[model samples]
Target: MDDVKQNVQKVPKRKGLSNKGQENFWGYVFIMPNLIGFTVFTLFGIVFSLIMAFTNWNLMKGLDKVQFVGLDNFRSMIGDAYLSASLRNNLILLIVVPITLFLAAILAVVMNRNVYWKSGARALYFLPYITNTVAVSTVWQALLHQTKGPINSLIARIFNLPMKQTPGWLSSSKWVLPALIIILIWQALGYDILMYSSALQSIPADYFEAAEIDGANAIQRFFYITVPLLSPMTFLLMILGVIGSLQMWSFVQLVTKGGPGTASYTIGLYIYRSGFQTYRTGYACALSWLLCAFILVLTLIQWNGQKRFSID
Candidate 1:
């Protein structure tokens, strides 16, 4: 009995997973649900949409009616006046990215200094970014009213102009895009400022100190040292900003409904209108693919340019 007991004790317990293996197993187990969800919802949706781009699969007509039309959807794009207008509007909105970047950098520099209520100021700037888009859109709509809005009212009083002389804003096609641009700039400022402020923290103080010691004024120091140091962040923000601007449709849909005769139309808004409003799901998918292609090309150009210009 003693010998048997010794043998039993000497026997290694049935080999199981090593500690690292067990940890990895549990890690994968914990992430499995999210992984599955992403595969099914995101990946599958992308594939499905790509396939649908070549078919006339209107939801109203049912999946059985999904007729493959080859490149008919794409071919139709050349004659799409609405799509052309949306593309033009999208190109125009590209200006928002640079303008927002410039303003955000300035504001970030100011916020970085020892200003009063610094934390409060940062929060105030970021508030609009986190606020509900619908609420912001609604408020802006009221504020940008042609004659009755407070903005026009203030302009009339300050400039000594009549209400009729004030810009039509959302009502007039001539001014509608500009009005949208202004609203977008205001709404975008908060996020950009937050990004710039965070990037500012990572920059070493040595550069600024050296600049000041070299007899550089505030403006010169800002232009030479601060801006150069922030180039990487600026590049990242530019890409994100451009993508966001291209994908922007919620504000257009909610505030102007791409109204004033398509002045505020965007590719994204047109896609939504095509898919849901008109049940042209196939056509919408084609347009979406086009937008995707444009973005991809633009992003590639930016990446290559950065690689060429960036320091080794």
Candidate 2:
């Protein structure tokens, strides 16, 4: 009777194992399409681009004409004056990321409080984020026109100065970058506010109630409880903001076109012009890899620092 009982238990165990195996097979089947697509489209392209970075192959040349000129492209980047200018422009724009994030956080905090038409207010703030980039750029272009733009007109009237004396925001090399930064900050503010609002909402109300009970004022509660708990989201936004700022191109392209003598040239614009405009595919690939490395290093730095402030 005991032997028969043991045999019955072994049969159920074998059946359970078979069921688990079948489930695993089906799970793999379900994900196979996405896996294949990613490998073909993204992974293959990245590997090919990395290989191209070491070669001297313009698009006009056949694959058979590709020559291995290892490190030459990389060395050229060191002395490339345009590359230096692009890096400088990107670094200047990096200031916008932090400022926008800070302002967004404040807006989120204010919006989180009980207010009339809060939903509508939030939507209004986020409108710029969803609006078409070209349309937004064009509107701003009109608004920032050197002579006829409303912004310049307002400034000229306020200061009692000639319209010509008013700053040439989009036209002047000195002012173009700052103008771009302002527009970018305005455009990005809505999304950042939304992200921060979501993060704020996720915090438990009980935490705030508890802090209040312990004699903490609103300001104290915000800095001590809210900020700490929001650190994870803050860190995430910082990383993403840095990455996005580094790759910023469209605004510069549509607004300034890296113009007034390439003063607004960013790495992204440089890479695009090199590959598509100049047909220097190899050099463009090299520039792209350098950008990838720069982003990777910065991301790793932020990741490492997260442990100090992130909740988990």
Candidate 3:
């Protein structure tokens, strides 16, 4: 009887293993196309770039003509004054993200307060984010033109400021990054508004009702109830904002081209220049790796801070 029981258990265990294997095989088969593409495109390129970072190569030089310079590319990046300035611009991007989010949240709250045409307000806000980046940059470039732009005209009227043709926005050293920030904020405000509005919708109505019954003022409810519940969404926005800032390049490319002596330059623009403009492919790879490392470190810090704060 004991032998018979052991045999029964063995048969069932073997059948279970066979079934599990078959399921896993099907799963692998289903995802194999994606896996193969990812490995070929992303993984291979990453590995290739890693290898290239240690060498020096250009179009003029053939592949085998590459020279191994170990950490020299890294050393070059440290000493490169342009790169330092670009990093500052990148940091400015980080600053813009949260400010944009805050503005969006305020706008969203007001719009979503059951005001008429709430959907229209939402659409208007999101429109800028979905607009063509190049077109927006061009429009901004025109608006910030020194002589005839609306912004300078407004400034002249409000503050009685001496216009003095206000320097060409993208050309001016002091204002290029700031100008870019303004455009970025304008472009992204809508997306953040939509996200915060969605989050507000997801929040249960009970909290607000109870607060209303307690004779809570709008300010009190916003602080004690809305803010606490919205923390996680804000936290997510923070991370994405930082990442977007770190990867920022399009507007710079469209407007400044890292011009006026690299004032409004960023790491993404730097990498693009090294690879495409300068034809220093290997050096570009090194620059990319450094950028990747910088982003990784900063992102890790932000992520850790979020977890510690228990934003979720």
Among the numbered candidates, top lDDT falls to 1
Residue-wise lDDT of candidate 1 within 1-312, one digit each (tens)? Answer: 999977766655444865556668889999999999999998998999999999997968989989999999999999798999999999998999999999999999988986899889988988888888899888988998998999999999999999999999999999988898898888889899988999999988888898889999999989887898888999999999999889988779998999888888999999999999899999898889999999999899989888887764
**TM-score of candidate 2 on Cα atoms, chains taken together:** 0.88
The order of the candidates by lDDT, greatest first, is 1, 2, 3
The number of clashing residue pairs in each candidate reads 0, 0, 0
Better of 1 and 2 by TM-score: 1
Q: Model 2, 33-135: lDDT tens per residue?
A: 9989989988998998999999887877788988889999999999798899999999899999889988998888888986789989999989999998899
lDDT of each: 0.90, 0.89, 0.84
| Candidate 2 displacement at residue 98 in angstroms | 1.1
Best by TM-score: 1
Q: For candidate 1, which ten residues in a row score worst on lDDT?
A: 11-20
Clashing pairs in 2: none
Candidate 3 deviant stretches above 4 angstroms: 1-25, 160-162, 165-168
